[model samples]
Target: MSFDHEQRRPADYAAYGSDIDAGLQAHMRRVYNTMCIGLGITGLTAYVVASVPALASVILTPPLFYVVAFAPLAFLWFGFSPQRIQRMSAGEATRMFAIFSGIMGLSMATLFLVFTHESIARVFFITAGTFAATSLYGYTTKRDLTKMGSFLFMGFMGIFFASLINMFFHSAAVHFAVSVIGVVVFTGLAAWDTQYIKESYRYNAMDDSANARLAITGALRMYLNFINLFQSLLSLLGDRR
Candidate 1:
């Protein structure tokens, strides 16, 4: 998918370009709105689970806790992947996104149990501000972010492996290092995903179903960036109760 500039454009082209720009803006707004709603659901669900001992007992136990932790991964693979979700209609994708968001919230409840509310809120705002800044840069910049996407993905994989090793080793230093790298990787990812989503917009396609699928996909990407960024910041800066 490429957009080429002739450097010397025609009058007709500019008029058509204005219409496309409006469509792209509208599409981007939908993506962001959907992402915000999903985040709200996740945050609410997490808080509720954390506050209720009965829910916590059911969810936070050894076997169940493991399931809760891994469920979101399962959802991403089976439920939210492009091969599956792209084939899905707008309603179907929205429902799947909602379910995945809830699963993510269940996984995140452990954070509430482990950290103070004040610290969580503080780190969340920090992540939000950082995400907003980098994502804006991505959207507005003329430079392509495509090259960095693969490298950032590799960094994410490295962090993943280091985290798994640290889980067994119980190493604070390793964990701290992982958190730092995670922040960097996800920050880059926020920018890369934004640019990717922005560039994906085509001037010609106006199919509502296709647009909806794109919006859901974009929402999922941004949601992931926000959640991971918040978690990383929490690990680094959050004070324990």
Candidate 2:
């Protein structure tokens, strides 16, 4: 009996390990799928707003434009507040994310205004490829990314302040530097976020509701990374209209 129990223990452990691996994969797939849907919504919204002269005239104009520009920030601050997140159902979270994606699209409609369509498309592909490779590295690499993520976060904050200052100075040099640094920061963030999301599955997998919320939030993080990366690369590589 002792020998038989010992033999079964190893198989039980192996089966448990396999279950965990499968769960993690499914969680990651959910995260990626949600992120892709958000991206699609944002892209479709941006294209529609940019292509329609009536929509552009209203949205890209002064007062409404400010609303469009800051709406996503508003949602992030108020909609995703700690209390709100705790109470938010999976359905509500999904809807909120969708709305935020559309608002981001409105803000990003300026990209279409500033860059040629062909150049935008080209730079987008470049950004996509770069993001995928970096995220894959983050997912597969055994090395801890927590330290690297911390360093990159500080760099990101520096550039954020630098960008605000440049808004007043209108310095081309600062703009160029920020663009370059932004690309690097956001690209690194993509990897860091992927690793974070991958690791978070263990805790979140116990509850369906928790896992659903995690997927939405994870998607939002990755979506932001992709968007920032695309914008930074576009500024550096895109041809203006």
Candidate 3:
């Protein structure tokens, strides 16, 4: 009887472990799916907007150029505001994601005008490969990335401030420095954010509504990280048209 009980306990534990693994995988899949859809929307919107001669012309006007350039930052600030988003429904959050994607696409459409098509495509694939590898490491590794998060956040802020100052200075050196730092900062953020998102699921898996909110939020975070990384890498590596 004692031997039988011990054997049954191991079987029970194994089954429980398998179930947990399956659930975690499904959760990760949902997060990635949501992010991929957002990226698709953003890319399509950018392409469409860039291809419209009249709209592109309008956006290139000085006053409108500034607005188009800064719109992504504004949307990001609004979308990631926890206090503001807390009151929002899941549908509302999803809508916000779509709106934010469109705004970002509008801003990034200028990239099509600035860089050669071949260079843009080349940089995009490079960015995609790097992002995939880093994110995979973050998701699969057992190491704690919590410490890396703070360092990366600081680096991002530094890059942000430098980029802002360089806007007025118009220094090519400054631009090059900012691009390099931006790529590094965002690459670290991609890994750290991926791990953080996964851990968040472990913490909030029990509440269905909370899980839905978290899924959307996680998607938003990862999407932004991926987009920013790609843009920064492109700035560094892409040839101008």
Candidate 4:
């Protein structure tokens, strides 16, 4: 009787474990899907805005240009402040993601004017490949990336400040250095954020509200990382138009 119960217990545990794994994978898929959709929206909007003469003219106007350029920062601030906007729903989150993507697309339209089409395409593919590989490694690796997150965060902030200062100084050397460091910082962030998102799913699996928030937040983080990395890499490698 005892032996029979023991054998059944193992089988039951195995089945339970399998179910949990499947659920976790499905949740992660949702997160990635949201991120992909956001990226698609951003890309389409960018192309349309850049190619339309009237739209480009409006966006490139001095005042409108500053607004479009700074729009991403505003969206990011709002997105990060969930506590201040507790009434926000998942649908609202999705809408925010769309709006943010559109803003980013408008900002990125400058790339169309600055870089050769072929070079931009090449650099985009490179960024996609690198992001995929890094994210996959983060998801599958057994090593914990949590410890590296703080260090990477500090590095990102430092680089961000330097980049801002360089805009005023207009230093070519500073720009080159920022691009190189920006690539490294964002690359690290991509992996760390992937791991953080995966672990967050495991931690909040039973809470639907938390899970929804995590999905949107994770998507936003990954999307930003991808855009920043792509821009940095493009600056380093792309041929100017």
Candidate 5:
């Protein structure tokens, strides 16, 4: 039942390698499917809210926009904290994920008013193509991605903190630089996360509860990467309406 590195067969990949491999593939598929469904909900919600002048006007205004802008971060801390979410039951995870995406959709609804629909669509497809290809590389490649994990985590934090500062500075060049870095970091993260998730699969005998939670964790990680990638590309490349 131990996932300890010393205990698990690092070389053998467990005795039932084929069965475990097949199970891992299925697990990864479920992770991806869950992430995509969450994204669909976010996108649909954003479009619906944005299309309605009343809703958009109410939500996109100052105090309300601030709440929307901050809601996802709050969700990350209060609801989806790493320690908390890793132990969450399937139903709890699903509900929390749905709520997080809903809040994000509300926050992002302003994009519809700010950018041309054509540009938003273009950036979305671009982000999707890039994420899919990079994630595939992570899943299929032989090279270990663990080495890149720490570096990418640092880059992610740098982007996040820099964003706070840029809120006031509002320098176009600084914004552009961060946007470019944001895309690169998130893309690399998507690949790394995919590989990590694939390699971290445990035996069914080992705690079924933890194994199930792993899929939810993987979906959340990949979803964050996709959302960040889309937002960064949209900021840099999307045309204003």
Candidate 6:
């Protein structure tokens, strides 16, 4: 959440504008590549756990399952806080991301149990396409998305609270509304976050350590958007097993 906005040297930019642009492109690719790797980890872990009956029974069953379900939240609170992230080395951040992705897979294994694999795959591709287009717009468009990001973040919090309430109420109508709003909110967030990350790179371009940490955080933001969008779309479109 806390990014160092150390401005790049004006002389350096004037002298090597092309080089700076190339660095920005490479930085964005690094962000996307890390996100894809995290997704791969999550997908593989989810499939392996879901395919094993014994493993599923032990981890996805009852009282112990809550531990798995909430472990990512605990990790975010204690390990991946802004303060902790600021202090982490590149290697440490990478390990944290891998561990978080695996935990997320365990939490989401129920998706495989509830929905047909074909529909899950279909929804994932749809989410990916939408993410790509929105992110491209964010990167290329002249319009500033900072204010939109703030508004969408508020909507995101409202959706979060509504989801928590619906978990207790178990209302079909609320769930439906939340799913629709979640899809919209996450879609917009994908663009906002992409623009935010792109802009941040301009400021932190000179520092390797800052850039390394920024890439991880940027990837984390985009990865969350993709996951939430995919889940929302799956809730609306996936065929139940």
Report lDDT (CA) for all predictions.
0.88, 0.87, 0.83, 0.85, 0.87, 0.90
Residue 32 in model 6: shift from native, Å? 0.3
Candidate 5 global Cα RMSD: 4.7
How much is 45 displaced in model 5, in angstroms? 1.2
lDDT of 5: 0.87
Over the stretch 120-237, how does candidate 4's per-residue lDDT look in tens digits?
Answer: 8999999999998888888998999989888998988888899878867999998888899988988888889899888888887777787787788888889989999999999999
Model 2 per-residue lDDT at 143 = 90
RMSD of 1: 4.6
lDDT of candidate model 6 versus the reference: 0.90
The reply for model 1, stretches above 4 Å from the true place, is: 1-9
Query: Model 2, 51-155: lDDT tens per residue?
Result: 999989999998898788878878888886434655789899888888888988988998898899999999989988999999999999999999987789898
- Give the per-residue lDDT digits (tens) of candidate 3, residues 153-178: 88888988988888898999988888
- Distance (Å) between predicted and true CA of 80, model 5? 0.8
RMSD of each: 4.6, 2.4, 3.2, 3.0, 4.7, 5.7
**List of clashing residue pairs for candidate 5:** none
Number of clashes in model 2? Answer: 0
Q: Give the C-alpha miss distance for residue 128 in model 3, angstroms.
A: 0.8
| Each prediction's TM-score versus the true structure | 0.93, 0.92, 0.90, 0.91, 0.91, 0.93
| Candidate whose lDDT is highest | 6
- Considering lDDT, where higher is better, how would the candidates rank from best to worst? 6, 1, 5, 2, 4, 3
Give model 4's TM-score versus the native structure. Answer: 0.91
How much is 153 displaced in model 5, in angstroms? Answer: 1.1
The list of candidate 6 runs beyond 4 A from truth reads 1-14
